[model samples]
Target chain A: MREFQLIEKIFKPLTKGCDAAQCLADDAAKISLKKNEELVISKDVMVENVHFLSDDGGFKIASKLLRVNLSDLAASGATPLYYMLGFSKTKDCDEKFLREFARGLKSVQDEFDLCLIGGDTVRSQEKFFSVTIFGKVKKWQILSRNQAKEGDLIFVSGTIGDAFIGFTKACESMKYFSQRHFFPTPRIELGKQLLAKKLSKCAIDISDGLLADLRHICHASKLDAEVFLTKIPFSIHAQKILKQVQDGGRVCSHPELVSGSKFTTLDLLSHGDDYELIFAVNPKNRKKILHLAKSLKLDLTCIGEFKKSTQKKFEVVLRNEKNQKIKIKKFGYEHF
Target chain B: MREFQLIEKIFKPLTKGCDAAQCLADDAAKISLKKNEELVISKDVMVENVHFLSDDGGFKIASKLLRVNLSDLAASGATPLYYMLGFSKTKDCDEKFLREFARGLKSVQDEFDLCLIGGDTVRSQEKFFSVTIFGKVKKWQILSRNQAKEGDLIFVSGTIGDAFIGFTKACESMKYFSQRHFFPTPRIELGKQLLAKKLSKCAIDISDGLLADLRHICHASKLDAEVFLTKIPFSIHAQKILKQVQDGGRVCSHPELVSGSKFTTLDLLSHGDDYELIFAVNPKNRKKILHLAKSLKLDLTCIGEFKKSTQKKFEVVLRNEKNQKIKIKKFGYEHF
Candidate 1:
């Protein structure tokens, strides 16, 4: 779709109170100030062949992950008001590139009335895009990465690791898991719905691997976590395929499969791909949180608990064949 | 000199409420609910090689031009709030590479308290950084890029294009113009101090060359402009060197140079170096604006007036031997 058409078809319907004929049509965006509430804004970058690849399917690459960034605002339960977009126009960025990227951005913006405010455009040898989203919440009501308590239970929303499995399957044969990999939905609905109600004192998106990210909350909160091994959610189809892979003689050589096995179904708990929420809630309020998730029509899963710092209980635990707890110091994925 | 030290030396000591340290040092930043203001946020990218190359003098590449991005807030009278950063650590990025980048980023951040809230890190074949800044302003005072009046006078803060010359000089000898090219002072003091009072009806940073950016404001405001050629400020040094170059035949033979003669001093004016404010003010408030600038200890120049639009006007007038207005149709540097 053309730029204007893409906005018209996808973005125009999403925003509110914007001077559409002017701001959306022009090169930069316009701002209107409404008082009360603090604004919490953030920007993140996703690079081609770095954070994602063209082989992953460009259309989905452009769209699904856009939701991943938007999910940050949702995690804070801040109403997304607008966005400033930065695009790296690479050689591979042609009509299709522009069309899909625009479509993805427009659809996400529409989902939250996140207006295209102002950003920069530049040519690069490779493709990349960074979007800054703006949102607001009552200062006290907003959740953060630093507020988890030791006694809180770690919970997640929706299914975990399905996206990772989807990515693997897509790589195996461009089939079956297109939607999972391409249009992985952000838990915006669940995130926004969870705001201000203090069941999970701390929150963040599962953008990086799950275990790696949980460590972020733990580190920030200055607490230790003890995730139950069996409670981790594994999709039914994924469990079956993984079993077959494990039974196959060649499975051990494939690191992901063994990585999956070494952790039992639980380390999949730590493996990334679950865009589901991984937040902290007090034991007393667990029922309330489950009730809230059900009311919001989002799945709620309780898989772990945060404990007071042990001079050293910060390990990812998995049950061994001997029924002993084995610690894996290296979690799901390591960052560059 | 180093990332951690820079954060400790410059940013750590800054006055912050109990929340700043708790929230910022963690993976996120926190805001106490005291302030209630409308939020106006934006993000801009400056890619390496694409936006600025090492040849562009490390320090100037570090500091000065980045202000062009901040000028967006100044135009809207929004205070500098916080900045989100994205830097790709390339193979070429050694300690010195980081030092310069950090120095440049620190200078701007210090000036604007555009606190470092959150960002991403990655490795690239090339080094580049993109920044997204968030600011706040009251509802009534916000400026839109598309809101110029029919007869509004177009004014710019300071002279246009010095940064442009510094850019060229940096290319010739990075060590020579490093001050001008690398450490571009973002005029934040002037932006914050003046626009906070609503002296200008509309304002925008002169990141792109003057003529094109003015066109944008005019287009957005639904008006046409008639800028005076003589009023356009050219630095004394720019005039001397350009005239010398033209006399020797270096510039005289080129149509691009000859055509852009009216804006010739543009190495300062037309190039994107001068991070000055280009804005439109209602004719009635011109005296008040001048008065406000004088009180604020800032330089405010009335470059030209915005006129009714039947057609576009070429305001960068030059004089021939007969002293007639010389035509300068093609305008300043085009980023795209």
Candidate 2:
């Protein structure tokens, strides 16, 4: 079957009750919004061997791709309503891969209550997955990184460095950490709570590690940031590994960084694929933000603080226990 | 520079004054719709070697990708607004290529007054371009192929078979046809006119050739159609090449079928890449549609009529000058 036929057979069924999808028969889909609602849009692309392992199953790849886009939506405190998928596959791709991909999408549809409205499937020399997610938020209620205010306390949802650690330990063991790297849980409800309740002024999703994404917020907001080494949140597994490295040994840590105090914290903060929310809240709202995090049963940490940029250079400073600035050779994940 | 930094340097400038874009710095962009407007969404993907030549200029590739998605929006009678782009390039792609690509996008932005809100740029093994465009239309004004009636007159905007003919003669010296294949003008205003004035009941953009896209319309509407071969519109250049083939010799035609009267019309109808609009209109509203077409300075042709499907098998029949059914060896472009 051709690409359109395959879409009709395998993908159209996923749009059952979504009137906006038009049963995936039209050239485009129509979505109507309420008077006070605005659309939150984002697009993400993943390539084989770059975003995921070449041998990864189709289901995992598909789910991860969609979830990453959802994570972006979650950052904006938008409820995802619809999405368009662009699947470009190599010539050797078979029907089984497509079926499993569709199955993966169905799982996301059930989990998020969002449906695919429109998309394209094309043949390429490489396998690629791109998704453009449509989300809805009340007018003027959307969160943005550029809205961060000076003196605002920087907060992050969930543990940091888990995904990076998982990626490091993939070959050895640490299946849980590895799975965290493979599948990320987007903080949708927490983001909505923060935005809807006006608890936070700015937000960003941590895909390029903590330091890099924090710098993004600082850059956009025309401020600088100072992250406390002791305040960075870590899961029990990540903490245990870090403790091991601190005790005169390093295993499954970054290969290039030398083992010890100089490299440990910065390494954890620079490696990416975390898929967690990082937001800025006023110091007065810290207690309420903590309460919301507790009600949601999620680990929230005040990792850093935004400061005025004297030189107009957006920067992130990592401070050791002595409150002295640590020199950083690199900032974060470099896409080039 | 890293990918995000490159984005900041190159792309952020393109989003000037588009408040919803957030300067392309945020993880997601926010857009608000008017009280009576609905969002029309479409996506299209293009890959090197499959969709275009590997050596094609970045400007052409970028413009083509955006235009095809715009064509989808046009078919739905939506005014183009914001778009998100996903660009995946191989390792060899450099700054110059990206600059040209951005210039190409600037052309479209200038033409349509649309802006890029958010997107992703990734490194892949092959060049891939995917765009998801969000358009606006009045509530309940979206057009679909499923609304065609049995007695509706089938009208097509512009000429047919030009792109296919262009593709066939690309190796030879047919610059006009070749350019037509590279760039297709989306009937944005004409589509809006048809939808707003209620001049047509159902519509589709002819991307996969006349016969194939017509099949899509017929299948959706539960009807069949009879297209008069003599009535199919053709450009002056397309007619010249076809005439050369009809003069007892076949040149630059498809290799699968033996040339002559049997294969000529079927081949032209089935091969795709023509980005014209094919719509169905009531016989009572034909005069108004024609007048609108004249006012718009567009060539609109009544090439066929939809018929009730006897056995629920949606089909298209091609008739010769004598009105005899012409057998077709193949349908349209099938991307398996």
Best-fitting candidate, scored by lDDT: 2
lDDT of 2 by residue, A1-336 (tens): 567668878788878668988888897988888998988889999987788765677888888888899999999999989988887767667788878888888898889989988888887767888998989999889888889898999998999888877666522466878778878898888889998789986899988878888998988899999888889888888888777767745565434334332336567788878889999999999899889988999988998899999988889998988999989877778766
Error at A216, model 2, angstroms = 0.4
What digit string (tens of lDDT, one per residue) describes model 1 on residues B1-336?
343454454435432433433434433343433234555556677776766776544455556444656766676677776666666666565666566666666677666776566665656665567776656665455656666777677777766655555554422343433454455555655655555666555666766677766766776666766665667766565556567655652232222244323324434545565556777788887897788678766667776666666654423333444556556555556654
Q: What shift in Å separates residue A166 of candidate 1 from its native position after superposition?
A: 2.2
- The candidate that achieves the highest TM-score relative to the unseen native structure: 2
lDDT tens string, model 1, A55-135? 555566657656666677766767776666676767656666666666676776666566665566676777777776666
DockQ of candidate 1, scored on C-alphas against the true complex (2 decimals): 0.36
Task: Determine the iRMS, in angstroms, of model 1.
Answer: 4.0
> lDDT for each of the candidates?
0.61, 0.83
What DockQ number belongs to candidate 2?
0.81
| Tens-digit lDDT string for candidate 2 (B1-336) | 457666877677777659888778786888888898888989888888777765668788877888888899889988999888887767767778788788888888888778888889888778888888889999988889999998999999998887776666522576787777778888899889998898875889988778999999999999999999999999887787777766645455434334333336467788878889999999999889879988999999999999999988899998999999988778788766
lDDT of 1: 0.61
